[model samples]
Target chain A: MSERPPVPVITPGALARRRLHVMFALDCSGSMRGDRIASLNYAMRSALPELLSVAEDNPEVQVMVQVMRFDTVARWHIDEPTPIEEMEWIDLDAGGETAMGSALAQIGEALDSAEAGPRQLPPVIVLASDGYPTDDIDAGLEQFFSSAAATAATRIAIAIGSNTDLDTLERFMNSPEARLKPLRANNAPDLVKSIKWATTAPVKATSSPTNAPDVASQLALNAEQLEAPSSEVVW
Target chain B: MSWRAGGATAIGASHIRNKRPNQDAFYASPTQQSDPRFMICVADGHGSDAYYRSDIGARLAVEAFIEAISWNLDSPEQINSLPQDIVQIWRRLVKQDIGRNPLPPGFERAPGRASDRDIFEPYGSTLVGVAASEQICIVVQIGDGDLLLGYEDGTINRPLAADTGLHGEQTYSLCLDDAPQRVKYKAIKRTETWPDFVLTSTDGVSKAFVDDAAFVDVVRHYRELVRSGEDLQATINALPDWLRQVSDNGSGDDATLCLASRRYKIQDQ
Candidate 1:
């Protein structure tokens, strides 16, 4: 067989390839200033290598990322589906009120706008906040979950500190089938760990070929302290 | 005219790196008991550490499928009930395996005897199969694999409908809580014409494409090659390498492809 000429096979283009989208909604409001936002930025930047590791680990999926920041209002910090290789995290200055609800609406719209469905790996959304939303988070949840594509996404949250609204964060992390709670980062170490877990676990759970919607829950069950406590409540 | 087939499976790039088992299995058999009889099956084992022994589950699925179809083929009355038979045979096989390979003494348990069905979690697998004779084609499935039949007219039909209840990587499995109820079966009568070609593949093959349409076109391309006189044996021989490339670059998951073609005699032509 080795001696014979190479045989031909069908191959699809990049456009035809499956994609895994991991969207991040960072709270850049005033409370996230100082150690909070700094740690958030540092941790997020450090997560790039691990995320790259995951994308390399699963060659079949094209990992695309988009970042959203909500202060007085929500807007794309890094808009468009940027391939992981081309991604570079830019630090943000915290200012204004928490518009997390608007952030959700925006994230929902992004998922809605995609032409993706079964061919798309269910998206992983991480909501990082250190404070309560000044906007109506409930309405945002309703709007986000209203989109079937968004509803199926693995939405998770990272609580920056003690002041963060556990109730709202829980609401955002809610799932009809998965019992995932927020990942609280008390210090820089916890921030790094939570960020790494958020970046890797969801990709591993969602990218595989035969996983259930609650695959993340199963992973969470095995992980000893996937949801252990208090962040200084950094933004 | 009669149908003949070939199939191949390749381990995923990641599975190899992780030292994990192939976890994908396929089976095909052609028999002369009838004028023309053919059968093919593909099963995908669930991934992740939770389903640790899914590779064994997938292997048993194909084995059970062949046993069930072969035993029931002669009994038309019992053939329609193959969904139950396949699952029953598969569970029984799992039970027997557990008996022979009993867990180590310290293995954790719920402090009671878990029935064979209740303890079948580690063996979860999704199966799709087809049994065909000159008169009809019987298809049965409980998961993500697909079945397609193509004729000379450029029309291709998927005999087993997509299960809308499933989404993304989620699928019904032979080891689910209610596998039999979820199993779907279809028997298509070959009254109009015999399909020129038939293809059955694991979800990995389809997941590699942008959409279902693109995957179907891949099958169409293969059929067109056959129509243009490319040798069947050559294509079959190359299937392993082709599928390996697909798994390495296309889906990064185990891939399986099985196909058959109708051989025509002068009288049939």
Candidate 2:
């Protein structure tokens, strides 16, 4: 008989299968003041924990999140992502010029150092805005969407008000297939729903939806029917 | 009877013997004799996607690591050099090797795939590995995985250290699916007077042993078990169950570990 010791049998355990990291870029510009900011605040307070549930017991499956609030200049309310349990309600003040450009720039910068895990999904950036941008929208969008890095990143957008420029917001989403939502209500429910969808969307490493717009309808969309063909965007 | 060279190695390894949809790939070799040189490499492919011929990707990674070191094994000095643009070169080589395998049936091959990134599409897997000698230790990873070093004193340390920060933002890991630019690396000079053990694993094992102290304890115990004259195969046999018990049945990604001790015989040196 062989004298070598016997090898042990390892029964596989339930691992935290799905791991994701999501970032939210909120438009705290003057147009987002009053009801808009309030709705966003309420939505965030209710949504962050639910998003954390995606990780389950897998402490390794962390969602390192960051929030950038923009007016004339983008201010990082939560520059680094805190654990969902540790996250707090961010009270945004709306009075500065719309610096959506600066906000996009910051979003790109923050994702630069982001890391991935075994099943790391692409970093998800959700941009929520209410009114038309007072800043150069094209330049801001370009800054956020131009590079291969930004294009490689997953971007989703939610148009918050009737005055919310759908065309401009479309540009804010980096992926042609970026998920988009039109929020008709300045209420708490709509805010929370939009936040939930943005954080939970799968951004798996291999089959990252480069054109997320096609997948947008899979997420929450506004009541009004969109005239834009979702298939048009690819990058 | 005296301890003989190559008589045994303390490296501990265990995996479910039965092939389950996804297979784990690993390679370990004791390259240096005098300095007790050794290397452990591992990779885990996502099991869900068809594009995840990650098993092949993982196998390629370990093979490439072995081949790279083997090509330069004579020059012990080169391991610490971390050669200029070595990271980039290593990345390119991995991409090429991973792409060399024929695409599974129903997958189309893109002709004249000009770039490393382009030809190596639909490929993803986490890679973590270590190359060590008596005097030096080097670790590198791109995506998520863990590297552990157990010293002779029973003291254990994780090279990436622990992310104890509020949100643990500083922690980094490899993702098979990240852009080549996003791939990161970590390396350090080895400094230990006694025999040490090194292990590299996919997230499967990391998840099983999430708590550093708890994981280190298991590793320490297993090392002792093997050193006590238990067959290495016995220790390997026990790993999966122990991991399941330790993880309390968390997520089940393919788990793997390559354990090797620094003690070698005078002849092998």
Q: Which candidate is the best by DockQ?
A: 1
Q: Can you write out model 2's per-residue Cα lDDT over B1-269, one digit (the tens) per residue? A: 11111111111122222132343467666433324566677765434333245556556556655665443444555654333233344456655754576555544443443443333433445556776554555665554567776766777777664322111111221221233433343444444344356667665565544344445565676566545555444455555555554333433445666666544223322
Model 1, A100-156: lDDT tens per residue? 999999889888898676767888898988899999888998998887777777777
lDDT of 2 by residue, A1-235 (tens): 4564343333233234223446777887776777778778877776677666654433434456678888778878887766555677667777777777778876666655554332334556778887777777777666665443456555667777556777776676533344343434334455566666555553332122111112233332332333242332211
| Chain A only: TM-score per candidate | 0.88, 0.71
* Candidate 2 chain B, run of 10 with poorest lDDT: B1-10
TM-score, predicted candidate 1 vs. hidden true structure? 0.90
**What is the RMSD of candidate 2?**
10.4
Off by over 4 Å in 1: A1-16, A176-178, A212-214, A227-235, B31-35, B104-118, B192-194, B226-230, B264-269
DockQ for all models: 0.45, 0.09
Sliding window of 10 residues with minimal summed lDDT for model 2 chain A? A205-214
In terms of docking quality, model 2 is incorrect
